[model samples]
Target: MRALPLSSGSVLIDLHTSWNSANEIPISTTLAYFSSSFRQTRRGRKGIASSSTPLSSSSSFHSNSSSIRKPSDRFSNGSLVSSSTPLLSLSTSRELELFLELVPLRMRNELLKHDELRTLIEVVIDLGRKPIARFPTGDWVISDETVKLEDLHHAISKVGEFSDDNRSGIDHSLHRISAIRNRKMQIIGLTCRFGRAISGNAEMIRDLVEGGGSILVIGRPGVGKTTLIREMARMLADDHLRRVVIVDTSNEIGGDGDIPHSGIGRARRMQVPNVNLQHNVMIEAVENHMPETIIIDEIGTELEALAASTIAQRGVQLVGTAHGMTIDNIIKNPSLQILVGGIESVTLGDEEARKRKVQKTILERKGPPAFTCAIEMISKTEYRVHHRLDATVDAILAGKLPRFEVRRVEEKANDSVTTIVEPEKHSLHESEVTEKEYNTTQIEPTEDFIEYPVRRMIKRSNTKPSSTRTLPVCVYTYKILEADLLQVAEVMGLENDLNVTDDIGTADVILASSSELKQNRWIRSVAKFHKLSIFVIKVI
Candidate 1:
């Protein structure tokens, strides 16, 4: 490879087939070909454009070089970024070939007939049933012949030993094979899931990965949770240059073998012999390996949740996935509840209860959450982000709506991936706010128990001047300086929205100290008559 001048966008390439001897990347050779071909193809093109037909994985397994992923360009939070280098899918053809071997010969040929072979999600082979090949669009019957004991035994022999978790994987590949045992403990069914370590899928949350916070990922099965984190581990290890360790319980993260797969890049992998002892391995990964980040999959059970909290306390960034549709599911689960701050009933004092305007005994967050942020994988390309798990969980416990961002990941024709974060809506259907509410920069003041969005907590800015103006919120301040009130509004940049008036009758809200509100019964009566909200400040 040779460099080109800054004026010319493309680099002059002299390609050769070679592998990195250090075992740094299992698919280094493929990366070399992909990088060179991509640059050569763009030498004279005016602009990359999109066609109606999405040819992504439409033709063959390695449809184009875009499937051969490389580390994406650096990006920041709260904005969109793209890359010239194409992102990767399963790097090598051998991954698919090895997985196909597990299927019987008759079924294997039928699977090859499909045009979108790249979209192959998994294959279900059950005893006395036709082998079914599932894709994102739908499922296909591979053959008319029913699967027998021989076909099951053939798949078992090709993969590594099924651990206590009943899941095995092909050596040096990310493909996973899970067994369904009979009453006598004989293998009756197999679910062969072809895992792809797509590098750029995790790019949407790269900011969180680098933020050094323990993040718990929750989603329904088959939403690409494991695949997303596999690349995240690689990104942290190779791009951010951090020490990352994967506690692979089912041998799915690092693949199966003493030699871990290169899909995780330079990150090391620790194999858990038994699923029951996964927590011990998680702890050992932190203590023995001295890693800055630890990645775990299927973090269920109380012990695993406790281990995650312990690792988080020890100052290790953990990226793990659990069983749930959303963060609310995890909070409601008895065993996995601790991962998000556990809920405990608290009996508030009479004064305190009145202050919050809630019942005397109510549910409250028990302690600080182990994970700082929780993400819901809504789909392969969309994610619902709870930027602060503690605040989100608190709001949920208080029976208030939690703040979240719905991000859609799109790949542009220019070979750049863009992450667009939508404001304050979990989904398009969940959005009840009007266009004005969605774009409002300032917090709309509300009283307790009022359903107000929390987007202002994350992003606050000055509003551009509009032709129309609403009535200013009249604030009657008691036992406080009027200048101080004006100054505070100015500091928050909400002066335009504030009206500091001395008249109590015209006030929408009363700003008073705790001491003054108790003594001034007249002010309280005036506020009550006008249906005004009182915001109390602590007395010094």
Candidate 2:
């Protein structure tokens, strides 16, 4: 491509050549003459073009130029301001190509230094009115060669100048912004070896998409979890047109300030400015925006898990990452457990015997056999099979699988249930009980087990409430009725130093008093949050 300045005036004409060859040299000389005639008829600061030939011919190279209208001229119409955008037009793709080269490298670095590069980039991309192209590695690629600087400047101006009331403009730009390199063919032509993405404790990207599996990816640092997630989003969104909305917490997926420097397909995304409101943004997207799927980076808190569950409840699929090396580590976490379904113990069997037995057992059970495929972790590059036997044993012990299978896997069933039992209690000293509370000792033996109700009182104080500190004694009074709450006391066993209550606001896990127990929603909310160990006393 070459730009020719007309001799008679300031008019410039751009010529584009699809093929690069020596024969195109004559066309460049011919383009210079065309530029002169285009400039001769114009007067004052305005410039016009008179084409010797229209652009509809099958010439070796085609020439096109707009009437050279100055920025002030375009902006000066009868209304005091003109509607013509002074920014570079998308009339020719090559103008975008030249404008990107004008961006100073130093300005780009200054942008990268912002504390919230991700959110800034989201804003920039939202303002960029061009479609993006997807590469196989899952990062978005912009040729910079194909984008005009004027268009980019307008987008950057929009992002940097936004105010609270103009947030609607931001939203509008974000929905239209894309994060992929737009092309008719793959930018990189190498075949993707996909079996390895599981090393970081993730299933294959293809499996998650095809099976509609909502994945919770976990990995130790430096394990390529982010890389996998980027590629996964791009493939699913560009290839399948799955409506994937990502909450890029750190901008690692797309990079700094508006145009996605990384490829993530054509998916639309929201970048949370600070990490504080991530859990909240995800919930809002699911509730208000009709997203088919939601993706978040590094789930960090209990509140996030609660929000993810709410989205899943609405049937919107979720994909997120966390820090861990194994499935067991995730399951053991109170916050992580909410988003993740448990992985049954996996024991790989030899193909010949295992396949035969699996086929026979699946036929006999008469229900769809549980997933028994081998699961591989991407970080360690190791493999293990999720077997029918292990799943059956897990289900049977949990009252999900039937009794007939329980008998077949006696040892396995016993081992699995051992992981679920409540811990044993140590003896409490009698001196711990105060003189005024010594008479309140109650014990009962039901057919299945024993229950204990004991009371202790030692001190009185006025202190600010703490969620981390479990209360030793609780009493409920409502509608002038009193109920003993020894079970709540045992569950919130501050004496044992375990984090028992789920509330982040209060130390005491008190149920509603008789006056409030009639409010069924209030009662259930308390019980669910506290997870008390035994029966809740009822008083009238």
Candidate 3:
């Protein structure tokens, strides 16, 4: 098999020849070209492609003298900005061919020839099951042939040695191959993940990087966290001229081999010989190299979190990622909570507790967090930014939700990227709070006559708010029947948390009709004085 690059801006892949043991390929071996579905964005950009008959996977790669890596462009901070983003550091899937080259020729030519796989994410192969291909849209059964020992051997031979973590990769490419072992400790499966370096992806948070404060990014796995930090390292090293060092574990961030990939630009990389020694290497990066910025891919350990705090104390900007959908995840995680400020239950004095309008004991920040700012990645195009970690943590402890600032990004087919910074909102809607708060499985049905209250501090319960258990809330209902609301709470399994209180002084929240609330000026004044949340209900 040979790749023929034609002058008409298309490459013809010659699959007619035998790729396995010199045997003539079957009649299905036909020439493949870039399909119309294959979108070619710009001269330097990479585009996803598919064929009528799958040649495993195909991509559109175009390059020219103008398509060189340039400094990433950032949109000016605003409510909305449609500024056309310039061609950032050029990216291409030219190296993707290396991943394709690893497939056992027999499997590639015969097995994956008919299925259409686009926007490829990963490929899974198990010993007894048929090989499966996964992409962003969905998954597909790429081959009828069950993975055999010979096929696994073909892959293991082509890649780097699998580490203690059961992960290996191509020396220069971003493709990672991870192994699965049975109870006997024998390899039985392999998951191959394709990695790409996206330029200008971090441009949305340019101001955060320039602030010179430690920033911790929290998100679910495979949300492009590694790719984001790779660009950040490059921007800090090549664009801003800051000394940046990356603690690349498993070669996911910097690729494999002694030499790091160009994706990180001039930033120096310290490869961890072993995953367990990552924390030690993190400290070593600061004590020895004197880097201005240290980029860590995943801070999954308490020791690593401690190391991060130590790094922050030394005045080095720390940019790292941890596994979590929200900063609250980091706050609740015993090991990772230290990354944000550690939580402590403090018993307040009589006057202090009464003045705060709460029980004697409450959760408080132990100290300044390692990271000054935390970013919750909603998606590649959207992000929830928490500028002040200390303030955000304090608000959560006080049973008040912190304000949210969101950033939205949209890329045009014409190669221009647009970014919009939505206006910040301090209050969350009733439905938003119901779905998001406390991991409660049941939602109180919205009623026209009754307004559902958000999470409020219940004076009855002393236990801390947790995802597993609900925090009881004290509600002082004026004119609205307490029995009706109490019945609703019982059905939703919030009976223990929801209680009716006659004394307005002890209530965390007030529920009353709009007409009644107007008649009772004293109640309104007291609620304002206590800074309590008010829910308006209508007469049934």
Candidate 4:
């Protein structure tokens, strides 16, 4: 017999003619031996079952290993077990069984024996085509049996009726079943997706959740955005004792049923009657329920964005997920721009432009952002968090890369650990206060540049002259228009004292265009280390 390793930690045995003839072992006896071998190898053993049919018949068996064991036995038996081990680990075994019950008996038995059922993601069924099972690693044909009309109908009848979105789910389960229909409104194809309630997925941001501020999570499809949101709601409602309400649209967050899944803890759920009315439901959740915090999934519309802002303005914290990968995606999206503070272009006057040394036109944030923090999920276990959304957006608009913290979760056999990584030192930009310092520097006007009326007014004021002496300011321009600076000095009547230099080490102030500042981050680091005032001007 040859043994093949499966991804689920199970082994597949193939009985060959040589072993069958040489050992003359009965099929039943061989099956028992293999089952017992699996039990001894795996810890917290559950049950092991096997079947023995002809190799060509495509018969197989499956073993389910329990994750529980008595504390005394675990330690006395000389096995490595700890009190911190996860007790109820996530698995799709129950969902897979429910789905397999709808398939043909022969094909179902063949598929049930495969070890991949634990990691099954979805099942695809079409008329006159063989059914296929999809897993994270890859996909494979479940059986050689082709699906027929009766098979499709049997699957449909087993689940709830398809809704307007052509999607349905099993009762009290996270598994979603969607249908593709013909012109006559007859179901022709089906896709069954298995969902699991995974715990500890939101540990990376537990601090952010506990801090109580509006947070927006963004990621691509299937990156577990909804799962994280569900976990966050549960943590806040159950652990922190916060009044949380979930605006569940399509029944994805709370699950599919009148009663929500226990994964959401004590949080109450408000189901949207229609996808288009999600925004209305969001408002209703705030005004009618009076929740301290609102948890929403997939904020994708203009009205929903506005509603999010309104909820934040009311001083109610929001924990929600949206459609995008990064803050840049939110800024580029027209309908969703308001969530991150919409962008607008403004033309600066010639004098103002020369003071900053940049183009006349530039982009600026329109208003306060609805979300105070934004999290970008790089993967299931990794995230990039922007704690200061307003500052981050302003930095990005100024053509400088925003500083963000990287957080990742590392899972071990006993427990999971979270780590936060700070951005590189070179990526840091000078504070806005530092720029304001340089803006405060006084420059007395020259007699040749000052208007006669202004000179007369200054002379008539009888203002007492200060003892402090004005110092000559040497400015260094990098990627900043030299002509703009000269024009600025000429208008201010300080052309003689306001000297623009190329060497940064000899200058007191370093000025650069915003676009150049973002591209050249090293310059900012050098200026910061030397305690030099650096100013960034936005360019068109």
RMSD of candidates 1 onward, in order: 16.2, 21.8, 14.1, 15.4
Model 3, residue 411: distance off in Å is: 2.5
After superposing candidate 2 on the true structure, give the runs of residues whose Cα lies further than 4 Å from its correct spot. 1-204, 341-376, 380-540
Find the candidate with the highest TM-score and give its number: 3
lDDT of 3 at 105: 59
**Better structure of 2 and 4 per TM-score:** 4
> Which ranges in model 4 have alpha carbons more than 4 Å from their true place?
1-48, 51-96, 99-107, 128-130, 144-146, 413-540
Off by over 4 Å in 3: 1-91, 110-118, 413-540
Error of 2 at 69 (Å): 28
**Which candidate would rank higher by TM-score, 1 or 2?**
1
Question: All models: lDDT?
Answer: 0.70, 0.39, 0.68, 0.69
Q: lDDT: which candidate is best?
A: 1
| Each candidate structure's count of clashing pairs | 3, 25, 1, 0
Order the numbered candidates by TM-score, best leading. Answer: 3, 1, 4, 2
Stretches of candidate 1 exceeding 4 Å from the true structure: 1-90, 412-540
> How do the candidates rank by lDDT, highest first?
1, 4, 3, 2
lDDT of 3 by residue, 429-519 (tens): 3312222432211112121232433333222233445574345668888888888777766665667877788866667778887787656
Put down candidate 2 lDDT per residue, 59-128, tens digits, no spaces. 2123333434343332222111222222122111121112222222332333223333222212223223
Tens-digit lDDT track for model 1 on 360-379? Answer: 66666778888989889889
Summarize candidate 4's per-residue lDDT along 18-128 as a digit string, tens digits: 264223233556556566444444565433233222111111112122322232332221222222222233123333444555555555556656676666777888888
Pairs of colliding residues, candidate 1:
69-87, 69-88, 83-416
